[model samples]
Structures are given as C-alpha cells and as structure tokens.
Target: MRDMHESSADFSDSCIKEEVLKEKLLRPARDIRSILRWGYPKFSTIRFVADHFQLSLEERHILARVIMPPDRIISRINKKIDCSEIKDRKILIDGYNVLLTVDSLLKKELMWFCDDGYIRDTRYYFSKAKQAEDIEEALDAVLGFLSEASPKSVFFLFDAQISRSGELAGFTRRKLKEYKISGEAKTSKIADFELKTEGGNPESNVIVATSDGIIIDSVKEVLDIPACLMEKMGIEPIRLY
Candidate 1:
C-alpha cells in the first residue's frame, strides 16, 4: 500500500513537470515589431495568429491587446460578458434588432434586363428567399449562444406585425429549458411601451439588449438599467463564445 501511494505521487509530479515543460517550449517568441504589425486593420492578423496557436484564455486576452491596443483591458473584457454578475439578471432582447443585423449581411441579388427586350424580377424572389434564410440563421445563432451562456432568464420581444408561429415558440422554449435557461416570448404592438409599463421600480434589476439608441436612452432614463447590443453580423460576443 505504501509503495503504491509513493509511485502514484511520483507519477503525478512527473506529469505536472511534463505539462509545464511543454507549455514553456510552446510559448511563442514575443517581438514588439510583430505585435505592432498585428495592429494593422485592427487585429485581424493577431486574431488569426491567436486562433492558429490555440492560445489559452489568458494568453488570448493578452494577445488581443497586442493586436488592438485599448486604454482599458478590463472594459474590453466586460463588454464581452453579458454582465460581470449576470447570474441574477434577466435579459430582455429585442428580436427585430437581432434580425435586422443578420439581414444586412445577406447580399441582395439584382435584376437586370438583357441587351434584348426582356424583363427580370430576380430581386423580388431573392429578397423573399434571403429573408427566410436570415431569420432561421439569426435565430439559431442567438438561441444557441444564449442557451450555452445560460443567463438567468431571457425574454425575446417581437412585433406582432411579424406573425410568429407556435412551432418556433415551442422550439425556443424547449431549447432554453434544455440548457437551464428560462425563455419567454412576447408579441406587442410596441415592445418598448410594454417594457416601460412592466418595469416596476427604478432599481429593479434588468438588462435590455437592443441596438436602438432611442429605446436604450428611454430605458436607461426610466428604470436606470444598463443596456447592451447584440454583436454585429458575423460577430459574436467574444468571451461568451
């Protein structure tokens, strides 16, 4: 029994030493000139380099600054998180704000008449197809990200004019619950109006996620709650992912 315990301890120490040596050997040769070069086009090269090397979280954070020098690293980190203390906060998302950002990424197909006398209606058809694709893709991304991040609760508000279906409602509910996130949907003529009326006290804890400047300003004025926007098309909240 004593011999077995000693051998196990030695093995553990050896494994630790091997890991430490591997990390030291893998550490990149840092250069100020190379770091400055990474700043071109705002960290595009640096991000690629970080990803290529499979950098650890701490290393990635440090390299992120090398690529794009920011006055405050803490603020940059905070922006990536839904909140520093997000476990207790309910997140209200403006559905249209998320959809529109996604839609903007899709390229619009143009209809042009041939040299001969022919008419083309390609734009109309393309628009319809793109809209459907955009909605599905955007919803998947948003729901998947939120589900994994597991905010305390997420309420998605959509305009009644869009006419969402029961299937989508059921899908979102199941997905959220599966990931231990509470999900709810509300359809109102004006989501902002509903939010303002429902938001109880000035100190009632909540975070509204929207890109609308007007809505954000109003919410802050009324409830004194902080607001954040979903990331731009093809860009997700960094640390959360």
Candidate 2:
C-alpha cells in the first residue's frame, strides 16, 4: 500500500503531466481552427496539423470533434437556447446522440465542450454494447432533466439501424410514463434527417435537444442536454482549446 505522502506525490505528478500535455496541444489546436476557418478541406488540414504536431490517433480524434471553423461555431452558438427556454416547448430529441453523450459522461469517459459550444464525446459510433442497466442510468438522467425542465411534450427519435433500437425506444416510452412526462419514443430509419426536418419546420416552434453538428446547423433552436447534465453534476468537461 502506498503512503499518503507517496500518493500525494503521484497525484501531483499526474496533474503536472496533464498540464504539460495541454500546453503541447495549445498551438496545434489553434492552428487547426485557423486553417479550418480559411476553408481548407477539414480532413486534410487536420491530417497536416496532426503530422506536423506528431499527434497520436487519439489527439487527432479530439481535433476532429472539438474544432470547427469560427463561422460555423458562431452559428451553432447562436442557435443555443437556455434551459428556461425549454419550458412549455415541444422538444425533438436526437435520442441516441443525447444518450451516448450522457452515457459517456456517466462513465467518466472523454467528453468536452468543443469550440462550437456543445458537448461531444470521442467514442466510436455504437462501438460499445450497452447493457440494460447502463441504458437505464443514462435515461434516468435524460428524463429526469426533462421532468425538471417541464417541456410541453417530448419526442425521442432513435436510429433504426442500430441493433435493438426499437426495443430501446420502447424502454424509453415506459420510462417517460414513469417520469410522468408527456412524450413518445420511436425509432427512425433516418433519425438525423427527421430531426433536421422537424426542427426546420417554421410552424412547429420546435426546440431540439442534441449535440449533433448537422442537426444543430439545420435546427433553429438547440439544447445541449448533456452539457446541462454536466453542470448539474458539477463536472467541467475537458477543454481541448
């Protein structure tokens, strides 16, 4: 067993290493943003910066998710709505996108607020098999927030291509009822497209709950549920910038 002094030393060393690593990433993160703003092809510019910086695969993934051109970032930020704005509003939730980000946060995985002012995770798309309990835990946080926010109604849309997505939708519906929130959950063959379509509708006055860039770009108003959840949990996301 390590003594307290030894443990303190270890922790001090860990913090120092993290600060050093962050310092190393600072320039590359800035340059990537600058080039992206200049209309360079995103993939090639990232690759070029990564090569120049000798960034690992993990670091490259961070740049891909966390950095965006300034205009795009500003546009997304403009769409962002406060939690108070969600009350008595029809919310179209990108179910899996919100869930996975919340799941990553609950598991203490790599999650961060990108330059675009939304929370994102670096996890592979559907890379991990989600157990029922894990899904339940994530939903608890998701629905609990909905309950507190007092939305007029909620609609959760899941990707139909994911295995057992219909089942997940069913589980979500049951949970919604249990939380006494007026909501429905259904799987969609093109959930992202549907989210964009619904959010773009001028008649609906819809408020979308998602961190997806494409959907955010299309939607008039956006909510970052995981970011709200993180605030409630007092967890400051990792800052790549």
Candidate 3:
C-alpha cells in the first residue's frame, strides 16, 4: 500500500503551480502510465520517465501520485459509491485525511481530480500545532454532510500521535452530538491500520470516507465526502485524468 503522506505535493500562492506543468507533461504522463500498466515498479518507472522528460521534483511527485495503472484505476472507481447510496449505512471516517483535504479545498489550495475518481490535495500542511479553530469551517462542512446523508452511524478516528488529536476527537464528538448524528470520535495510534482492518471485514456493512488509496482499495465501499464538498462549493480540481 502506498503511504498516505505520498499523496501530497507542494502548493504555493494559494494556487497549484503544476497546472501548466501538467499540460506540458501529458505525453510523459501517458508514457509513464503505459509502462505502469505493464506491472513495472512504480517508483523506478516514474523516476526513469521523469529524467527522460527532465521534469522537476514537484512534477515528479504529482505523477507518482496522480497516475495509477489501468486496473487499479478501474478497481477504485468500481469500489466508489454515490452519495445517494450512503443512506442508512455505517460510515468510518479517516478523521485527518478527510479534514485536511477539505481544509485544503476550503483554502483554495491546489488539489487533483485523479484518474481513480478521488480528489486529492497536493500539499501536506497540517501538524500537532494545528489549532482546532483552524479547521473549524472544514469540520463543519464534513459533519454537515453526514447530518444530511443520514448514515446509520459514523465513527471518526484520529491519529493519537498527532498533537492535540484527542482534543480534535473531543471537538468532533461535540459536533456529532450537536448535529444529532449517532456516532463517536476517538483517537488511535494506529488509526489507519484499524480503518484498513475494519474496512476489509466482509461482514461489516460499512463504507469508508477517505481518499487514502490503501484504505480505499481494501474497502468494498467508499464515500468521497471531499468530492461531494467540491460539487457543493462549485470548485473544480486540477484534472489529471
């Protein structure tokens, strides 16, 4: 599974500088995609293509994440469920993953509409020092959606190692109750691992809300809350499909 950290690149000036770069690298992106379809090692294949194209580090990072093999792309799309399908189903939230991406979108940061039908932020910009107030609006949008979706139940899990995670969990719990949504928020050292394990459980009628490729691939059903938020905000991500 690819690390969740790798899904990001760097953003600047409140806009993604890579938009123009993406058009220039289209041919290289296609060539890299073709080689990736052959089951070649993703890292090495991308490095070779980047050197051949003389692409910069930022451009290379974008390709490493946004480009997926044909089969994997189809698998991801097939696993995705529409918002209408979210009714009365259990939702396991990847707390920070969803929060950060939506936060990025809210801030007008550079994000991607990847081929796999997921919206992803290119920059990693959160930390233990990140205050709850910083993501207040982002959190509202997320919890607001859940209230509207009317899921059977929701569980929000945060990474305990992150600074103030417990506080964030508490804050989320308050919002959940305020929203009158049936759910709880807690912190775990291995939140990602737990999400993956539970998501893989065939007996659980649960769909995960995350853009993490690893977790998405392991789960049978996925709800793209960020994408839904994008539609609501009338925002379009940088297209890399």
User: Per-prediction TM-score, please?
Assistant: 0.43, 0.90, 0.88
Error of 3 at 206 (Å): 0.7
Global lDDT of each model?
0.44, 0.85, 0.83
Q: What tens-digit string does per-residue lDDT give for candidate 3 at 98-165?
A: 99888887766667888799888877535535667789898999989888889999999998999998
Q: Candidate 3, which segments miss by more than 4 Å at Cα?
A: 1-19, 125-129
Write one digit per residue (lDDT tens) for candidate 1, span 110-152.
1112111111112221222223333665566566666555567
Candidate scoring better on lDDT of 2 and 3? 2
- Give candidates' CA RMSD values in order: 17.4, 4.0, 6.2
lDDT winner: 2
Estimate the overall C-alpha local distance difference test score of candidate 2. Answer: 0.85
The collision pairs in model 2 are none
Q: lDDT of model 3 at residue 67?
A: 83
- Return the TM-score for candidate 1, rounded to 2 decimals: 0.43
